[model samples]
Target: MSAPDVVFVTGNANKLKEVKMILASESSKINLINEPLDLEEIQDVDLQSIALAKCKQASKLLGPGRPVFVEDTALCFDSFNGLPGAYIKWFVKSMGLAGIVQMLSGFENKGAEAITTLTYTDGEGHFHTFQGVTHGTIVTSRGPTDFGWDSIFQPDESHGQTYAEMDKAAKNAISHRGRAFAEFKAFIATEFK
Candidate 1:
């Protein structure tokens, strides 16, 4: 049987590409794509809640009978006690890469976690949330990639290489977005089987 058509709503082209790759690697029956829909993203401390709210809002905006999904990624720092939990996007934008390093300079414990939350809708408005998390520590910003806050964050399983330092394949193998997409792909495969 053919899987349900999935529309991913996101503004990040890098993320969209990565999601396509992850889903494509999972099964042959699924089609992956995205639509640029400007939906209100509520400022919530919880990544899941934010993604879910966006999913619901997108469903209402796009009307019914469209299986759409929204993804939200955040980098939460333990030192700040989640001060920038879901607001990591804003933080990165306002602070820049060097500023992030400065933000952690005073704290002895620079632990952080990368979180990716995905909310899927079954066209009629049913929402399913899938999450992925990678524990790591904040390092001095490095690498040439322009994607988000990747330069400063190093995953525990990355062998000391930051996300920006790794290629697409390496990053996908252990990234929060990748893990979340992994679950998302599995869910689609089973549900549509």
Candidate 2:
């Protein structure tokens, strides 16, 4: 058997690097291509829909015969009733993480969750969507080892430490991306082979 042909379509450098690193294990049997697909990020919506839209856009750009993967993720806070669930990017830019932390201060509810929806589309326009979610809580302050919302978002009862408090490898090991990729790997292994 030969390696399957696929391309990863994303414009986020950080996310692209992360996904490529996670998928590197399949290099022996998969041709993983990374292409920056230009897609406008829509405002205030569930990430699943956003991910699907991104995959569709990439599929149109690539035409048919190859598979392209796209993912959109958001951090939802329980204290705010998921106010930032789909508006994370905008909030991150305008309010900054510190501002968000402050905004959630003095709340009895600091529970939070990271949700990721992976949209995988074959070249012919067929799509397979998978989701990965990690339940955690929001911390009063920041931690020293993670990025994005990791500094303040602690996994539920995570021994009083936020994701930022954990090492990169440790965090990635159980992250939303990790869960999603694991499922993607299994799916491809079973169905594509």
Candidate 2, 17-46: lDDT as tens digits: 777777778776678888887887666557
lDDT of each: 0.84, 0.77
Error of 1 at 155 (Å): 0.7
Candidate 2: residue 168 Cα off by (Å) = 2.6
TM-score of each: 0.94, 0.88
lDDT of 2: 0.77
The top-ranked prediction according to TM-score is 1
Clashes of each: 0, 4
Off by over 4 Å in 2: 140-146
